[model samples]
Target: MFGYRGLTISDDGILEISGVRCDYLVEKYGTPLYVFNEEEILNRIKEIKENHIVKYGGVAAYASKAFLTKYMCRLIKREGLWLDVVSGGELYTAKSVDFPMENIIFHGNNKTYEELEMAVDFGVGRVVIDNFDEIDILEDILLKKKRSIDVQIRITPGIDGHTHDFIKTGQVDSKFGFPMHDESALHAVKRILNSPALKLKGIHAHIGSQLHQNNIYKLEVEVLAKFISSIKNLFDYEIEEINCGGGFGIYYTEGDKRLSISYFTDVIHKAVEECFSRYNLRKPTVFIEPGRWIVGEAGITLYRVGSIKDIRGIRKYVSVDGGMTDNIRTALYSAKYTAVPANKLNNKDEEQVTICGKCCESGDILIKDIKLPKLERGDIIAVLSTGAYNFSMASNYNRIPRPAVVMVNRGQDVLIVKRETYEDIIKNDL
Candidate 1:
C-alpha cells in the first residue's frame, strides 16, 4: 500500500505514480530520476491554505530549501503561497522566475554581505535575522541602499523537538538563532529596534525537522508568546507576526505516521489565540514555513538496480545507479525509506536486500535490510517520500551527475531539471 495519494499498483504489478507508470518514466527520463506528483503537492498546498492560511488568517510560506526550481517557484507563486528562501541562490531562483519579491522571506545564519545586499535590492518581504553579526551587516546594506526592510529576529526557544540532533535547530546551544536563555536575544532585539533601517516585524523559531508531537508546537507557541509579550513591555514595540517555523512530519515508511494538516494548523492557531489572549497581547499574523510536509510524500525517486551482489550467509546488496549523489538523507541522517521493485509490484517472491548506491563509500546505502520482490539487475526501483530534501540536498559525489527531476500529473510527465553532465562537473573547476 502507498502511503501517499496518487500512487497505485497496476493490474500487472507495475507501479504508477499519478497515473504515470514507473517503467515508462524510467525509460523516458532515465534512472535515478526524481518524480514529483504535482497533484499531491497542490493538494498539500490546498490543505495549508484552507486549514491554516484562510481558516486562521495566517500565511503559508513554502520552505524552498526542501525543494526548489524555477518550475517549483512558478507553482508556489501560482498557488498564492509565500516562499521561505534560506540562501542567495534560492533567492535568485525565485527572482529568475519573476516571483513576487514581497512574498519572499529571506533566512540564513551567516548571510554574506552580498546576499544581504541582494535581498535588500530585490525587496524581500521579510528577512529573518539569525545572529548579531548579520544584524549589523543587514543594517549597513539597508543604510547604503537608503531603504528600510521589515525583519524578524530568529530566537532559540530552547525547546527540543526530540528529533535528529543534526536537524534540531531551536535548542539553545545551536548555531542557528539568538538564544533566549541569555541576553543575546534581547540585545539583538534592542539593536534591531534602534536601527532606523530595519523594522522589527516579528519573532521566528524553527525547532527541528520531522517532528510529530503536537505538544512540542504548543510549547513553542507558549515560549514565543511570552517572549513577544516581554518585548512589548520592554521596548513598547508590538510584534505583528509570529513565525512558528515548520517541521510537520510526513510518512517515510510503515513505522512513520503522517498527521493531518489541521492536526498541526488547528493546534497552532488555538495555541496562538490562547497564549496571546492570556498574555493580553493582540494576535499577530501567524506564519508556517513547511518544507517536507508539503512535498515529501509527493515525490518518488526511480533508480535502476544494477550489480546485485549476493553474499551467502551475509546480506544481499542490490546496488542502484544512484546513491548519496541523489539522496544523502540515508547516509547523512540514517534516514529510513520505503522502496519497491517497480517492475515486480505484483510478484510475491521476496528477499531481504540492502539497497546500496553506486558511490564508493560503504555508508552510501539507501534502504538497509528491506524485503522486496526479488530484484533483478535491470529492474527499476522506486523509493517513496523523497520529494522534500533529496533533490535540494543532492551532490555530485563521486563525480556522478545529479539526476533529472520530472513533475508527473494525470499520466503526464515533464522534466523540470535536466540531467547534469560531466561538463557541468568540471564547468567550475577551471
Candidate 2:
C-alpha cells in the first residue's frame, strides 16, 4: 500500500505509520508535532517515475514549496527527483544540499531582478517564464552575461482543474500564467525565439491542485497540443519539452481516488504521445512538478488533546494545543482531512464532533464533523494527509510558537526540524 494513507495503531495502543510508532514520538517530542515517513516520500518518487515518466519520458520535479528543509532537499536528490523552486530561499535550500543545479527549475510570477539574476547566475536547469515583465528582467541579466537562459513559458490553457478556487492556476483569469489565447503571450514566445538571452524550450500549464479527475488532465494536454500545433510555423517548435503542471490528487479518505501517480502518469503518457503522433510532432521530454502527491500522505500532524468540552445539547468540541497556526488548510481552504486517536485507534467510532484548534477564531475547526473515538485530555490525535501544506503554511497567530517536525524511518527516529523557541520568536523583534 502507498504509505500515504496506510497508518495503523499497534496492539500496544501505539499508533504507527508503516512501522514507525507515534505514541513514543508524542511522548518524546511532545504534542502539536509533525511526523513524516521517509520511505513513503521516496517510494512516491519511484512510483511517479516508473509509472508515469518511464513511459512518457517526463521529468518529475518535486515542488520544493510544500515542506522544504535541507533534509527534504537532500532526500529529493537522493531519490533522483528534480526540484522546482519558486524563491531564492527554496533555491538556497536545494543548493546547500548540493542538489543537481542542472536539474533545478526556477519558477515565480514576479521574480525580483535580484532573484532572476541569482537564478541565471546559478545556472539553474530552467526558468519557467510567467509574464512579459519577467522577460524584461531575464533579458537584462542574460544579455549582460551574453548567455541564453533556458526557459519554459507558463501558459494558462483555459482548462479548469476543479480544485479549491484559491489554488487553481490554469484558469485564464488567474495571475500565475500568460493567457494562451492572448497575442501578448504569443509575442512573448516570439521574442524568446528571436532573443539571444532566452531559449524557448517548451510550453507549460497547470490546471489546478488537489485534482480528482484524470480526464481533466487529458483535456489540458489536448489544448496544449493544439496550441503547439498552431505556433509550429511561427516559432518552429519541435516539441522538445512539454511541462504539464502537477495537481494530481491523493485520497484524503475512503473513495477519494487520488489516483496513483503511476497510473496517472501512464495515462498522461498515452495522451501526450497520441496527441503528438496525431499532429506529427516530435516527442518531447515530458515534465511534471508535483508537490502534494509526493509528500501529502507521507506527513501527519500530531496534536495533543488539551480539553474536551461538551456544550450541553449543542455539540462536543475536542480542542488541541495547535490549530490554524500549524494546519490552516482546514480554515483557509476548507480542506478536508481525517484524524485518528494515536493511542485509541481501535475504539469504536462514535458520533460526529468538531475538532477545534486552540486558535482564537471559531472558524479554526480542523474537522467539521469527524466521528473519532471518545477522547480525553492528554490524548494524541494524528491528522493524516497533511504532508503537503501544513508546516509550509503555519502561522504565528496569537503569538503561539510553531510545532516541531520529526521524520521516522525503519523504526528509527530523528528530529529533522527543531521546535521554535520563545527567544527565537522575539529574535526578529526590533
Candidate 1, residue 198: lDDT:
94
After TM-score superposition, the amount by which residue 55's alpha carbon in candidate 2 deviates from its true location, in angstroms, is 2.9
**Position 22, candidate 1: lDDT:** 93
Per-residue lDDT for 267-368 in model 2, tens only? 677888899888888777889899999899889999989888898888999999999999999888989988888888678867677899998899989987
**TM-score to native of every candidate shown:** 0.99, 0.96
lDDT winner: 1
- Per-residue lDDT of 95 in model 2: 84
In angstroms, give how far residue 173 of model 1 lies from its true place: 0.8
Q: Candidate 2: what lDDT?
A: 0.85
Task: Report lDDT (CA) for all predictions.
Answer: 0.92, 0.85
The backbone clash count of each candidate, in order, is 0, 0
RMSD per candidate (Å) reads 0.9, 1.7
lDDT by residue (260-314, candidate 1, tens digit) is 8898889888999899999999999999999999999999999998999999999
